[model samples]
Target: MRSMTLGLLALTLASACGRNTPRPAARADAPPCHCSHDASAPMAANQPLPDTSVFQMGVPWTDQSGRAFDLASLAGSPTVVLMFYGTCQSTCPLLVRDVKRVEAALSPAARARTRFLLVTFDPSTDTPERLSALAAEDHLDLSRWTLLRGADHDIRTFATVLGVQFSRVGPGEYTHSNLITLLDPQGVVATQLEGLQQPVEEFARRIEGYTR
Candidate 1:
């Protein structure tokens, strides 16, 4: 009777052990809790970066110096392009200031590798010389900064390709996105920085990475 009782007890223990297996504890390698990005988040990274989207530079547009410039000439390398109007009192200045901040944040190595390109939607007014002055006023180093202009048609075309939108409000005043687009060495847009709130660190990282 004792031997029979012991056998039954061992059988019950073996059955319980078979039913339960030890599980590994939760760890950092575990998948993050599933979550979605904000539905209303800006469409900043919506598309794959391209080498060169679309640019029209060869056509005649008066620069600030009143000399005609061809947009095609500025192609080939990575560019940080932004859209602007000369007479804007709001975002344009701030946009330039933000660019200046990015410039100041770059290491010497990055300074030599990247270029800042500004194209004016208000081609009628932002002559090359005026644009040059604007760059100087904002403390932009011309060694790597190139301001270009195109006829209204070319400007519209460039903006369309860049997905940049600007609306003219008053004589010389326009409301536009404070955007900075990163183009790869081939002229394809890698990313666009929308809004001035993004940190200069982010700018440096994006520029450094894209240009690299």
Candidate 2:
């Protein structure tokens, strides 16, 4: 009878030990828990740019408003690009007018998707204040227009990339080729018009095509 009682007591202790033991923790390789969308969450990586994009160059630029930006910042929109000095007498005014004409020809929807970039070859004289004054004088639509200036070396490099030739003709004067280039959203050269008074109908059409 004592052996039987001892056996029962041992069985009871084993049960108590089993009840006190904890379960194994969750698996380390378990899937992550789902959560609702959070505006403050970290952003995903940006999409890769095309190989032939001009934004591939790491050139820095400053706008008429004194804001600093790079070519990459202008991505995701069709751009009308031209190089001009702020103080030119002969062809610069005509180039600006041609750009204005192109802008006017764009449909409202296309206009929204289009942007204009004017880079100054004479950065020494075309300070932000001077560019701002020129923009105001020409009644340029500041909302969609950007005037840029950079270091002389960078300006030369950019001109070379665009195949634009320029040489200093006089003090504060430059003789540059009259070329206006249209870049797609990816910064690829889509079309180039080579004259101060070239018809903008085709250029507008190309812009509209890209925007669509």
Candidate 3:
């Protein structure tokens, strides 16, 4: 059972879309993407990543503090990532709480080296100011948590890299999968958790292993 769970979650990290994935409207200006995934073998910490690393993308981003950010800069630490918009009323809030639980489970040493990254799907609405407000409202520690927005095309590319499916269904409305990915120090996925209201103890233990 444990192996099966890990295998499925690993496939998600390798960018395997679910069978019922929604067909989002295509963007004419979106860049060509050649996402790759190899879940045939387990990844080790601190190794150099392949061309398929999520950190390989060079898309520019602006953080909640209105500072320029790079995906590659998160390379040297364990990162917990969630793709979400600030104004989401339903699942996004629950997802945020889930991640907060994961944070609370970590020891001070582990938490200090770990970072939480939130990327918004609705970049236009989730501007730097709004993201900052959301973080403050959530009472997230700025030093360890980051909220960022990028161009739509870049956001799509990044989401594809992580196998996070999302589509704008209505005005200020988006339907997306609830995914939490753990990236190793070298920016390769170490594990992933999907869905909501699930126990995060296993996820927390896996992260603690990487810190040791």
C-alpha TM-score for every candidate: 0.66, 0.77, 0.77
- Give the 10-residue window scoring lowest on summed lDDT in candidate 2: 31-40
User: CA lDDT of each candidate?
Assistant: 0.64, 0.81, 0.80
Q: State the lDDT at 192 in candidate 1.
A: 74
> For residues 1-212, what per-residue lDDT tens digits would candidate 2 score against the true structure?
54354535665665567646533332342212221132113222374556766767889999998999788877777789999998898899999999999999999998987889999999899999999999999998888999999999999999987778898877898988899988766676767888769999988987777666
Kindly report which residue stretches of model 2 are placed more than 4 angstroms away from their true locations once superposed.
1-45
Give one digit per residue, the lDDT tens place, for model 3 in 1-212.
Answer: 54365545655555556656542432342322221243222344455655656776888999998999997887666789999987798999999999999999999988987899999999889989999999999999999999999999999989988888889998778988899888765567766788887788876786676675
Cα error, candidate 3, residue 80 (Å): 0.3
In angstroms, give how far residue 186 of model 1 lies from its true place.
Answer: 0.9
lDDT of the structure predicted as candidate 1? 0.64
Residue-pair clashes, model 3: 0
Candidate 3 segments whose C-alpha is farther than 4 A from its true place: 1-48
Error of 1 at 137 (Å): 1.6
Q: Lowest summed lDDT over 10 consecutive residues: which window, candidate 3? A: 31-40
As for candidate 3, its clashing pairs are: none
